[model samples]
Target chain A: MTIVLEKPAPARSGPGAPPPHDDTPARGARALRALGRLSRLTLTRSVVVLALFALWELAPRWELADRTFLPPFTEVAAAWWELALDGRLWENTEASLVRSGLGFGLAVLCAVPLGLLIGWYRPLADLLNPLLELFRNTAALALLPVFILLLGIGETSKVAIVLFACTWPILLNTVSAVRTVDPTLIRLARSMDLSAPRLLQKVVLPAALPTVFTGIRLAGGTAILVLVAAEMVGAKAGLGFLINSSQYNFAIPQMYAGIITISALGLLLNQLLLWAERRLTSWRPQPRG
Target chain B: MTAKINLRAVSKAFPARGGRESVLALDGLELDIGAGEFTVVVGPSGCGKSTLLDLLGGLDRPTSGEILLDGAPVTGPGLDRGIVFQQYALLPWRTAAGNVEFGLEATGTPRRERAALAREHLELVGLGGFEDRHPHELSGGMRQRVAIARSLAYDPGVLLMDEPFAALDAQTRESLQDELLRIWERTGKTIVFITHGIDEAVYLGGRVAVLTSRPGRIKDVVPVELGEARAAHADLRSSPEFALHRRQVWQLLHEEVDRAQELEREAVAR
Candidate 1:
């Protein structure tokens, strides 16, 4: 007499886990009630966002600040629409995404494997860690001029700076992640006569994944932020370039549109990474509301 | 059965830490576990009971002397020995069956056979429908059952349990204890169950080994004589024979517990 749900059984451990102990349940009715409540919560939560939008629209229309500089929300949206329709925004966004993708991809390739090795062996970590600490403490943007001087102000410098900024969080976090795998699990694996390699592959990696993925998500955000700053300095086309050019050319609404697009891009990238994290680490009990 | 496991003058010492003197956990300890015997080792909090189990499991070497499994010396962890830790120590990310399959996979059993064996072991521990549940999804009792199933699935001859049910509630503990007895009867494992509970030792052990306080040595061994009732796994806790055995083991342990507490008190005061 067992009923298997499609979703992995969310046991009573998680926040939104089913209340199996409760007797009075028409499953369909309960789901509807939950959905209704969720919709209500969504509406209530949107009030703040809507209120902020209203403030932006009214403050500038009423001349709270100079309308020439701080145009209303609608004007910015309209300017964004024009740019999007003409594909100007698209062109710049593609350039920015390409730079970010290359830099971030390279960082992952270099950092994760390096982090694993440095974390596993004590002697290697001892040899490399002081050098890593020295570099990690030196912020990436502080080396912006140095990067431009070395790699030049082309796409290379922008991508290189983004890679530099993204590397530390990914690498350092991975090292700690491997280091902090519960010793109990290691003992259990050892008791099973697992070889050293098998122990790393099976026990250490899976245990360290949730933390390691956390590092990756942090780096994803870093990739965007650092790339934008680098682009502002010397890129021909990117969200940062668009924003800078619009401000200089006195196209205030276009600048606001570019700034808003950057925020949206950051939010979307975070969401995508979070989705991947959820897919891969589904074994972990997720915090639900 | 002859002594399947043997410890001859076994001792372990912890190196001095933070300018403190070295702590001797065990000294001149002698013990023997017969093949297919349910030998429960009971002691005070700091009597090196766990250290003894670690030595037998070959996770740690004895500081002096030696531990022997069969005729050979115990050198390191092997599939022949399985340990059930106090904390359940389950990989939280793995399902019950997946966890059971961990050892099977280590043994290089094919994927399909591993699943079948894992399911069989999970069923043996009365977790048939719980094969897919993660450790967090299960209750404390259920989690420990999965751990037991996992240790047993690898077909280890000697199972070293270090307070496996210590974290469980009283009712869960008793039920698990009964379940363990049934499993032992079925499997015929050479089990060395460690506990601080006198009643548990009396109930589970064919012979209970009472260990003395800090710098532990074998204080006494009480041969449980519950006979027919124990064999049936019946209502033996209330029986007069069970009472006598409980009292006997408690008496042997009471003095050592006090001595260990006094030493702990002095150390904490310092």
Candidate 2:
């Protein structure tokens, strides 16, 4: 959730190593050892985060920079507590979530069918491919001013910008997923004497799914990023607008708190998408080696 | 008597690389495959064995002449001609049963009947236990079995296998050949199998058609009436009579292989 703009030096030495262990084990024991290693990694990650936060609090108190601009970690945490007690933080977070969800949902709904058509029908692809390339290359953020002019600086403009930003990745992903499916599979379907609709339903869509899921995941990230930028432009609600207002009003701790909430929301959405991907692709075998 | 497949002076030619001269894959290739017959076609690489199968299966059109199934000219791919490729082209996304069901679905068979038929075909191929498994989960031999089962599920009049066991290891290849013969015998379907392996051709075919080099023409159709070597592919491989048939087919095909190699050298020289 921390918005670390600066990169820190990479960690080298860890706390301690376990005592020299036996190399040989039964299959069951080896599996348990792997699980143990995973837990250890999780433990180490939390410790590292705690250490970094401790440094953030101590260094600011020790006069690392002007405390007015860069508040101590404790001050930011206190500001977060105040926001939570007043219930505005959750309201802002929920507003941003709603915007992102609506935009991303719209993008997916529009992209998939269009992408499937473009991918499956060669003549359509031939006609529209150039236009698609042009639009995909044109930055979605670049259309923000235009959207504002057309729709005004309200929720609609912001949602539209998010949709625009998120659409390309999903559309392109769907196209590539369909296009890159093994030709042998298509030929096999045809040899089976499948109708065009049956071929698309049975052969094309399932094969394209893994790549489409990947695109959707990327689109999720894009949606969050675009939503924040759109909210920063002009919005009365949402964490992004909170961040903007806090900075303008010289509430440094509150600004940092808003930034932290946005980061957390992004991380949480990514994790949720990852879980969905795992659930959908359950047939994919675990790595053996 | 219904001749399962009849090709009348079939010819197929591919357009050569950006030139007036076309590459003739087949020329005046006349053949008749009867019901319950196992015919193997042996040819050097690029001698158009696959092209001939394509023509028979209505996968591609012969540039001249006709390919007929039961006296009717083939218009396009149909369920009457089922093909098994060397690569075992089962859709990777689908499970073994799903792959079998694809053809049934395409042909608009009732769902319950299709499921029963798919099960029966898989059982016939000895892949009964692997129905829910995807292509990736199965071994190469198992995958080919699934493909063969899929083809058979359609109950095609003729099964055309284009080197179905070519990608298999020698042991798997021999075993699959035995399975194929058992299935062919049980179903009483006509089969036209293609292979470059001399031993395989002799082991599987009642009649072996040896083909000449590019612009391929049939050189000979050597018939093997070894009743003792009929079904057991493993035992047939070790028999002296099987060796004699292999030698005869090899002799018929050797000149074609040499001619093909010479032609290849000439093309590479250019």
Q: What are the iRMS values of all candidates?
A: 1.0, 1.8
Model 2 steric clash total: 0
lDDT tens digits by residue: candidate 2, B170-212: 9999899989989988998899999999998988898999999
Residue-level lDDT tens digits of model 1 in A94-203: 99999999999999899988888789897999899999899899988899999999999998989889889899999998899989999889888877778878888888
Top lDDT: which candidate number? 1
- Judged by whole-model lDDT over C-alpha atoms, candidate 2 comes out at 0.86
What's model 2's lDDT at A133? 93
- Residue A33 C-alpha lDDT in model 1: 67
Q: Candidate 2: which docking quality band?
A: acceptable
Candidate of highest DockQ: 1
Write down the TM-score of model 1's second chain: 0.97
**C-alpha lDDT (0 to 100) for residue B27 of candidate 1:** 93
